[model samples]
Target: MPKNRYRNKEVKFFVTGHEMEMIDKKAAIAELDRSKYLRKMALEGYIIKQDFSQVEQLVYEVNKIGNNINQVARRANEVEYVSLDDIKYLKKQLEGIYGQIEKFYDGG
Candidate 1:
């Protein structure tokens, strides 16, 4: 990055193809084009040009994992006699991991 890259205050980041696919998938899931979604996030500072040094990023990852587990549970519930108990157990395990993630930010 050049010293002047931040002069205009908007910088371009080059992501790998695999990372681009993830961004595309997220944009599709959010029902917006990538640029539009990114602009909205930047304006709201939800995905913006702030520093992460003060906060733990794993908390964000844990929240995302919790969301994924909920989605999986929803899908599991749609099936008949497919070990809901085991699914519940798995969700608990994810929650445990989530707890650890939170603990990382909790001064532990």
Candidate 2:
């Protein structure tokens, strides 16, 4: 009654206690379970792990900038005037964003 069963074969193996501990550590780092980690290692012989916390923070900063810009635009529309200080503030925010992007790409 199964629609798809691509992985129908099972391979069983055994390892020592220290080897299991190392496998558990690596699986934790990769955010995968032991079975998936073993399958990936067996199939590809390697695993690539990446941290995106900085990128997530960058996205949060960009969202805050967008909100600030929207507020400035709304205020300008209401008063029909944009001040020099507002322009300077927006320019500074943009520069900060650019600096973050640069740092991210440069691996800093």
Candidate 3:
């Protein structure tokens, strides 16, 4: 709250209940009063960002798992599976690991 910034105009907008709850949680984690945090973000274009180093690590681990699967499958264009059940099981396991890399990749 800087007085030199000039007068503060109040503005209101509709938000979903879930969004409101998330705002409250974020403000609590930052130890900021809800209104103050909201106002600061609104006026300053500031946002709270999550630390994604752990997420990057998770992505790395998942990618290793996918590579291991590919290697075990002989790195072929087609997968060799004797049974539908086995393919289904493998797909389920890999689904959880998919897109995790994209989440943490900054596209550098």
Candidate 4:
């Protein structure tokens, strides 16, 4: 045990062969060690696994938009002129992204 460890108590229990197999499978599914899995299940009765695919997609979209905005900025610098319609379109795109972020936070 590490000196900085806070868990000082030891727990012992017995399980049938079948029960042990089930526990191992469940622990593997949760991607946790048996000790942590058992402790969490015993204390919290359940575990929540969060999925971030939507967040990943959001980041991808934001990056693409950022790239587009940078291209527009580069063009404006080269020409010394920026179209108002282009600015409006970029603003609309940004607003749509913000709406998605709001929806994510609001659990919509």
Best-fitting candidate, scored by lDDT: 2
Q: Is candidate 1 or candidate 4 better by lDDT?
A: 4
lDDT of 1 by residue, 16-58 (tens): 9998999899889989999877776667645348555435566
lDDT of 3 by residue, 33-98 (tens): 988888877877666787877677786777777776666577344654445665676677677565
lDDT of 2 by residue, 1-108 (tens): 354868878798899999999999999999999999999999989667998999999999999999999999999999999899999999999999999999999998
Model 4 lDDT, full chain set: 0.91
User: Ranking by TM-score, best first?
Assistant: 2, 4, 3, 1
Question: How many pairs of residues collide in each model?
Answer: 0, 0, 0, 0
Model 2 segments beyond 4 Å from truth? Answer: 1-44
Q: Please list all clashing residue pairs in model 4, or write none if there are none.
A: none
Q: How well does candidate 1 score on lDDT at residue 83?
A: 71
Candidate 4 residues 85-105, lDDT tens each?
989989998998999899889
**lDDT score of residue 68 within candidate 2:** 90
Q: Candidate 2, after superposition: displacement of residue 64 in Å?
A: 0.7
Which ten residues in a row are the worst by lDDT in model 2? 1-10
Each candidate structure's TM-score, on Cα atoms with residue i matched to residue i, is 0.33, 0.62, 0.37, 0.59
